[model samples]
Target: MIAIGIGLHNFAEGLAIGNSAAKGEISLAVLLVIGFGLHNATEGFGIVAPLAAENVRPSWSSLVLLGLIGGGPTFVGTLVGQHLVNDALSIAFLGLAAGSILYVIIELLAVARRAAMKVVTTWMLLLGLLLGFATNAVVTAAGV
Candidate 1:
């Protein structure tokens, strides 16, 4: 359920990127996609981390569903973004995304703490943020 929610949220972000690009906001679109793709790579790891820690392999159906939840949004968002690009709407969407992602991070941290893995959780969170920023920087540098 959480995975599906996260995936749908991600898809909405993708929509923003696609919408911007469709409107000829190429630079913004490219930057958004690059940043989103970078963040998503970490998200993939997040999805499997708990299972991996438990030494349990996710079933094929589960993996497929996870992938759909995680990736289906990119296509949908692209289509939506192509059709809409209002600055206020984009800002609102971003705020919503940030809030949801932050909640997920907090939940992950709580889980890690309960498992007595505080250090690893802290580092991973930091690394995720750094990677996100780094990717955004590169995209910005490229004038995208």
Candidate 2:
């Protein structure tokens, strides 16, 4: 489920990348890829969190499939945007991503609550937000 949700979220990121590249915004496109690549690194952990928690090692084939599902959209979006960039399409993709992320966040929060480490979990959530922002700051500093 997390994989699915994050994959959807990544679709939005890809849309941004695609649109930028299509418009000849090379710098912006490169920045988006760099920023999004980092974001996706963390998302990989999120995608496999449940498996990790259970001490289950995912098979190579499974990992491949997951990677394709989560990252393939970037390639597809890039192609589409290169040929036909539009605001409405971008908005719709982002809306879908937002919905998926919201659902995943709720589910993860429930899991944290069930673990009964409310204070620690809350702090971790805040820390994650901080880390995400820090990453964004780096990209912003790069003139994005």
- How many clashes show up per model? 5, 0
Q: Point to the candidate with the largest TM-score.
A: 1
What TM value does model 2 have?
A: 0.73
Model 2 clashing residue pairs (backbone): none
In model 1, residue pairs whose N, Cα or C atoms come closer than 3 Å (at least 3 residues apart or on different chains), thus clashing, are 11-73, 15-77, 19-81, 19-82, 27-144
Model 2 is weakest, by summed lDDT over 10 consecutive residues, at 89-98
Writing each residue's lDDT as its tens digit, candidate 2 over 1-144 gives 776777777776777778778777787787768767766776666667667666799999998888788777767766666676777775675576568768767866776676677998789789877877887778778776
- Which parts of model 1 have CA positions greater than 4 angstroms off? 50-56
Off by over 4 Å in 2: 25-28, 52-57
Q: Please, what is the whole-model Cα lDDT of each candidate in the order they appear?
A: 0.73, 0.72
Q: How many clashing residue pairs, candidate 2?
A: 0
